[model samples]
Target: MRGLKKEARLPTVYEVIGVLILFIVIMFGFINLLELPIQLALFTSWFMVIGLGLWIGLRYKKLQDGLLQGISNGLEAVLILITVGALIGTWIAGGIVPSIIYYGLSVISPNIFLFATLIICALTSLATGTSFGTAGTAGIAMIGIGQSFGIPLPLVAGAVISGAYVGDKLSPLSDTTVMTASLTKVDIIEHIKSMLYVSGPAFGIASLLFIFVGFFYVGNSVDLTRAEEAMGALQGQFNISWYMLVPPLIVIALLAMKQPSIPTITFGAFLGVIWGFAFQGIPFLDAIQTSYQGYSIDSGIEFMDTLLNSGGMVSMLEVILLILLALGLGGLMEAAGILHVICQTLLKWADNAGKTTLTTLIAAFFGNFFGGAAYVSVITGSKITEENYDRLNIDKRVLSRNTEAGGTITTPMVPWSDGGVFMAVTLGVSTMAYLPFLWFHFLVIIITLLYGFTGKFIWYTKGKEYTENYEDSTVNTTKFEA
Candidate 1:
């Protein structure tokens, strides 16, 4: 990995802003006007970075080194992404994910269906640590069940997305959680602990909203015939046993012990393969193959087939590429001193801890909106604001928490973004249709900003003295000026 040379000239703030505007225009033009996929759009942006570096008078070697350094930082996350993909494939084949959905479906009644939908999806996503996986599997089942109960599709979609993302933000197994912790140099457990102060309240309030909504549809009678048929098809294809839970349980236990993420997730994937072979009676060869090619189920039920037939190492290739390309662009900007210059400009306004936190939050949202990926937003926000946080004596965990609160939760709100597009396509509901019902997403933004302004949960550190202070720290505006 390359470090920025002290002698390298930094780009001016106006030049950085111009490059950013150009970058956004190119990306939006490709994705919206030209109708290209996100991968191609990202590729086009990488070239823009190269051109920007040259225009700024940076040597080619310096720019290339920055790109490589940025890509290197994400290598561990990429491995974890591939491992989680394999885990999903094997978990489905082993009946782990299916069992959760099957059991969740069996317990819900029409009256509490909406509330239960949120809880079930949350639990499934917590277990799998993947919002997309949860959405494609249990989320589909919830949609079918909700339709059967005559609930509005948008409401159901909202509950599913909210619950799925809650787990994605909190779960130890979640890639976003891992990436956030790593980027901020905070212990994974500490990052999660800090997040609870924000996510816990947001999730609780959202659940209550779902419950309130549930009251209206409680007595409305509808058929459960289709849901039963789907459950039957799942049961027929897989063993659907409690024993399938061993893998996720082990993962949680290991994470609680503060075990490293990569090995823990890899072990979980291996346990899933063993369980599939031993209990599900999947052929040994097929179990191994599924880790790479994904689980294949021919239940003859179209919806069931669509939901269950996902995961495997191949499924993560797009995400891996996106991370690499986005990080590369970030690296090029850093190498050319553009990121540092812009962040320094932002720091001019961050005269206090509260304003610093708010600045990070604002930057994160803009990162998701302009960068077009949650990973990009997280990396960009964390990298730029980390030193400002350090200078303000703020705990890194708080930085990681805010990054996720703003970046991860806001991506799905942008309709053209990859996260938004995936959720809309998976649930067959437009992003705009479900936008109003996404209480959890909206709540996170509000809660984080509230905490920033109010300093309710800010953790402070100054030269080894740690304290939890709820009172807002007075802004020393002149102390942090360049």
Candidate 2:
């Protein structure tokens, strides 16, 4: 478990091939047969896949060390997930989430619902550095509002999630973004800037799609009935004042000043708890309940209770579980060198920059086929393509761009991936239901491939400049050589 031994290691090729086969069987049982609940199926598959890895690692007496190494390697991500849970709990108790929901609902207009969903979710995601948080806090409210307006639910959720993921993918404060950059040894700003080539077009196209979709939203006769009722209910439950906005504002301010994510989120959560107690005069028990079990208030409206009563550490458990399971699967794959094998196999198809870029995109796309998260895909794909990019004289920027485009940005479209599952659950929509409306992800994938085909985005430098820019700086450690 501590590390790979010299003689007992399995070949990367077999490891990757086995992983692919295992996932295919799992996907078949879940998606085609519909044999179990999605969550259960996911958990079961993750366990089975990891069990296989453990079995292979256990062939030698050193298996215990390998297991410990695997778990230890995952410690950072586990801490991040735990902090995320705490952050969600505190945000709800603090009134920051409620405030955002209140204001977000106030701005709703049928004429601009789609674009508005995008903008609001994007801002929320940027603030929280979490698409899941944005979706749970604002996406649900938008969905309810959209339903009230007689707009299509899936399309609204799609626009909202697309925008949310955009911010989540780009924000320096995002855990996934930070993890990707750290794992790849790229500066966060450089990685973000590099993504602009792909993400920019995707965002624009998604916005345009939302605009077009908005036109189809035929106004629902302006339903102030529900809105008024919900607002009144909200006011009755909490001290509805401007002051409730301070904590979230401060969190954003801290992020702008380049504070670290765990601390920043923890700070926001702490202030949220304070707001819950001070303004609402919630009892200590109630404060604890609200932070962990969520708040419950009767506001003379059933829907309002359902909406406001949502929060707590408990609300985020599903997502937190998903993260743990998905990351566990990823850890096993890393331990088995499955990722390296997959990368090696794919690199053989790249004969030119165009092919190399396409191959990278394909590798990323296939990553979700194994049911992990976007950060896993991006890091794995980036490492896989680094050597190929250098050999083909492609810039590292190009490699980074493709990885973000096909791996990071597109994860939410795959139902098995962490981002996808989280978004669907948060918005109360199915992944397939919103697939057509996720124009941003599609656009990014398309633009990246198009650039590859046209050779427009490809840069080949000769002499010191090319050597300096295109040379691979990727660190190598597939086996536990040490």
Candidate 3:
């Protein structure tokens, strides 16, 4: 809708495919061969999209409009990212995050350590509705504890990522979950309930795998000396009190009550500042500064310093820029009619519900690969597949779940993708090193695909017809006829 040229010709599916392959090749060359940053690679790819649009005869004005529209769609998400970064900084400075790490370390033993890590990170991410925040906070502590227990960092990173993403997929506060629901016109709660069909089983299996793997490492002699030292450093740095948890609890309570994300997270950050002042004896000026510039702890231990020195609005600028660039590329592709061509070709094969779901899954995966962002995939994939879902009598919740199943889960697997790069950089682990250990990632995809082929857990509508009603120039609504 953003880029419509009445006289412009649409590209053929084959032509679009050619352009896609070329784009992938260029991205690979930049990222793998030249070792460019993912942001730079994406920026370069944006130029490619622009060139293709121009060569295909798309007007510059239309392309510009499309790019602006795409960037505008992500403005809200960008603001949330910045706020989450600030929350992380304030929480760390307030001793909230450290308290979690400190208390979490106390009960976890080598035997059930990996399993406990998965559960703890999962709950934290679910409560916070942020995988990145969970990883940067609780996940960091788990890594330290795992290292102290002689567990491989790669394995720990994998479990942490797996748990973090599980919540990111299911939590109502998650941006991806919200985006999927909004795009598909499903109630957010219903969308979350629908995901439970797939996520519930996947998480159970993943938890069991971690437990089984933990058995082999149980009772292994570990040097608790390093862990004790790290704990001491944490205790000495900030006031270690149970009251530190009040801030995150406030956040969870607000989210459970269905408060909007921006205000909810902002309130949480403010509570962190209050706690920092009241309990941690942090100066008012310092607390305010940390909200913008991030928390800093010079612990002398490089690992502890690395883990503690994070957060603030400034920390998220790179990710924000990456989202904008990726969306800009998506806009150009849409303007040139490349995405329309591809979607139309894919729809040609969707004769039934199962095939349509599978087509959607495939489209979302490729969309993340091409678009370089999960939200971009959701927007494009949902728009392209909505009519198909309607014609097949499938519930929109199914489409929303599949969009997350394919787009959200697949983003962190693609090495050059925004999610992947952010995870790798944040966790201090290579993407390749942690890839094999992400059981939830692999399981979610496999289970979703299995459900698609078997028609298991696919919801269907009964005796209801969907009708679009346009009441005025500014008001359009969908009506359900029973």
Candidate 4:
């Protein structure tokens, strides 16, 4: 018993692969063919992973520790989810959301709406270094505005996601941005420049595509009756003044000051509660209640009421549950040496810089797929591939860039991921619905892949110095040792 306790069994590659194949099939089948909630699939998968852990000679206690550690990786995101929910609910009751909608309907041209939504969200996330805030605030308003113009909500959501993610990727204040930089041992500025090399063109391409697609929706906006009615209802219900913007401004200011996200967002939520009482003439108790249960109204205008009635602490319960289960499943996989076995199998094929980069990306992606958090994914990807990168003489910054491209940018596409679940729940658009239209993310990932194969942005480091070969841009890591 003591000998067994001292060391856990390592599962063979065959065991891990068989379990993974089963997990993927069931996960997709539950989500697609059965049309069941993802929570059920995640719940079911947790048990299967636990069985694997026990079968591989790992103790239940060790597996539980892995689960807790995985959940800890997302503890920040969990708090943000809860806080943002209350912020949304109270912001609506306080007239903050409506003000944006009221003014958005007044000035935003339908012809340029999609293009405009992308840019507005991009800038907001860029400044605040938060996609959740950008989407929950400006993205919400963009949805209402786009719907008023008769545009499909999914298209608008795609634009919002593209803009939000792009800005978050490049923002100096973003946690993922800094994490990816530090793990690769690269200067943050150099890391940002390397990402810009790929993301910049992807953004330009996405912008052009949005601009072109914006014209197609021109017919939808020709009749502004919905817009006119929404504006009128917004004005009748709330003050619709500039002061509504103050809450978000304060949240942004706090974030700018490098305050942690949890308290900053919570402060914004309570501020909304105060505004609901002061400006909307609601009783203090009722306003606070809205923060817990979400805002509600019988405004006679169906769409206006639907648009405005959202956000609350309770509304985030399901998302929180998903996070817990997903992280638990990730923990089980990690503790049983399942992910390590798979990553090693994947690394065997990484013979060249391009292949190594691509393999590193797939590993990062699988980290999100199985690890269930960006922090773990980025760290796991960087650590697993660091040795291969050193052996191949490729710069680790490129590895870091690939990590973000796969780990962070592509996170919102995975339904079980924290980012994916949050975006889907917040924007009222399913991840699958908006996924096809995430032009920027898709473009950036594709560009990163191309760079790996064609050696477009692949950089080589010399010896142990980690300095780039500035004079010889064509220095090839694939041939560095050959």
Model 2 bad stretches (over 4 Å): 1-19, 30-34, 38-96, 124-133, 136-150, 172-190, 218-224, 365-371, 465-482
Output candidate 4 Cα RMSD: 5.7
Q: Clashes in model 3: which pairs?
A: none
Ranking by TM-score: 4, 3, 2, 1
For residues 251-289, could you state the per-residue lDDT of candidate 3 as single tens digits?
777766667778878888888888888888899889977
lDDT of 1 by residue, 1-482 (tens): 26654333456678778878887787788877999876677677777777766765567887888788866755665676677678778878888777766766678777678788899889877876777656765676677667545567899999999999987899888878998999899999999999999989999999998988787654454557766877898789888887776776777667556576668777877887898899899998899888888898898878678767876899777667766676676666657666556556776799776788877877777666544567767876787677677777888988998899878898788664556755775576888899999999999888988888888888888667444332332222122111
Maximum-lDDT candidate:
4
Name the top TM-score candidate.
Answer: 4
Across 385-444, the per-residue lDDT of candidate 2 in tens digits comes to 777776766767778777777677778777757777667755667889998888877888
Clashes of each: 0, 6, 0, 0
Kindly provide the TM-score of model 3 when superposed on the true structure, using C-alpha atoms. 0.86
Give the least accurate 10-residue stretch of model 2, judged by summed lDDT. 466-475
User: If both were scored by lDDT, which would come out higher, candidate 3 or candidate 4?
Assistant: 4
TM-score of each: 0.75, 0.82, 0.86, 0.93
Which model is ahead, 2 or 3, in terms of lDDT? 3
Task: Give residue 60's error in model 3 in angstroms.
Answer: 0.9
Steric clash count of candidate 4: 0
Q: Each model's C-alpha lDDT?
A: 0.75, 0.67, 0.78, 0.84
Runs of candidate 3 with Cα error greater than 4 angstroms are: 1-6, 125-137, 140-144, 147-150, 172-175, 185-190, 218-222, 394-397, 415-418, 430-432, 459-482
Model 4 agreement with the true structure over 202-265: per-residue lDDT tens digits: 9999999998888775654556987898888888889889989899889888887778778888
> Would you give me the overall lDDT of model 3?
0.78
